[model samples]
Target: MQTAAALRHAQRILVITGAGLSADSGLPTYRGVGGLYNGTTVDGLPIEMALSGPMLRRDPALCWKYIAELGKACLGAQPNAAHYAIAQLQRIKPDCWVLTQNVDGYHRAAGSPPERLIEIHGQLSPLFCQSCGAVDPQLSEHLQRPLPPLCKKCQGILRPPVVLFQEMLPERAMETLHEEMAKGFDAVLTIGTTASFPYIHEPVLRARVAGGFTAEINPQRTDHSAAMDVFLGCRALEVMELLISHI
Candidate 1:
């Protein structure tokens, strides 16, 4: 209720989301690509190593094996009510922005404006050639054919724009985030993430430091929960619609 009131009154809002939010859509919520794996892959490599940028360069087939699985999982699921609720909230609040770690692109699928949505981790579709920089639109088709999809233009290996392990976050997304953070927010509501990383928690701290409201929604208390003005211990799917309705 407090978070809803703060969001309703606040003109500038930042809604931070993570993997847990998309899990409501039946997507797995583990490390790397919603993480269909836990300890190691069939190749006997750690999931992180198998999904890393270096691995992609060294053995694209191995890397893409996992990538394809994640891609299939994402393509199989639809955005749930919470995603739609956030999209609706964005429509209601012109200044509302979504900063998400998810690469599933569910926010975009749920009708959140691309300009207002920041996918810090990048996305899974529109695979591009690392060699010729050619855009490949046949991700689903390629998935059905090969281990490492190749570019039609140059026969180069195609990969998603997503930020793999050991890869840097997208520069443009980071720039946009910093620009908005400089402008500051009146309310910051973090959903579904543990706020374990500095980037994840920085916005919340910024809002609080600027004398604004900050809250979090998660089924369990997280590293940043104690810092929030109000912590809603519930799934985003369970409360996001209620929160948006109040707005």
Candidate 2:
């Protein structure tokens, strides 16, 4: 209720989300690509290395072993109520935009407008070839068959558009974020994230400095929580529906 009150008057709003937002849908709250594994994986390598871009290039099979796990988890789960609530907010507020770190594509599935949604960490579907630049839509089918799915046309390794460990963020997504940042937001709401990355925290800081309302919705307190105008200490699934109703 406090978060809604703070944001109710906002015209331009930014809803920044992370893995925690999707965790309610039964997905692991991965810190980047490694949180599912504590320190090292069963393969005796750190989960970061196991899921890194370099590792994918070095041993596609080994890298894809973990990639396939992520794929299966995403495919098995559906978007939760919080996701739909955020989508609804976007519809009601034409200026509302979402910037998410999760690769599950649940926001898109939940009906967030693609033009307004920025998947900062990239997404997990429609695998593409690394070599010949071919696109493959059979992600679920390939996951069932092999470790590293290959391109049908070039026999190249097929991978999702997701940002792997040790990979740069997508340029276009970053550009869109900065562009919007320059225009400024009337309010910024962070949900289910620790605000660990610069990009994640920068928007919140910018909005605050610009005298904009800032709030966070998370089950636990994060480093950014103390500074929020309203910190709803609860899961997005629990509070988002109510927040949307207020908006």
Model 1 CA deviation exceeding 4 Å by range:
30-38
Q: Each prediction's Cα lDDT score? A: 0.90, 0.89
Instruction: Please list the residue runs of candidate 2 whose C-alpha ends up more than 4 Å from where it truly belongs after superposition.
Output: 31-38
TM-score of each: 0.96, 0.96
lDDT measured at residue 238 in model 2 versus the true structure, 0 to 100: 90
lDDT per residue for candidate 2 within 1-247, as digits (tens), equals 6678767788899999988898999997543344444676778788878889999999999999888888888999999999999999999999999999999999999999999999998998889999998888888999899678988998989999999889999999999999999999999999999857999889989999999999998999999988888888889999899889997
* lDDT by residue for model 1 (1-247), tens: 7788888899999999998899889887545442334676667788888889999999999999888888998999999999999999999999999999998999999999999999999999999999899998888898999679988888988999999999999999999999999999999989999759878788889999999999988999999999999999999999989889999
Query: For model 2, what is the error of residue 40's alpha carbon versus the real structure, in angstroms, after optimal superposition?
Result: 1.2
**What is candidate 1's local distance difference test score?**
0.90
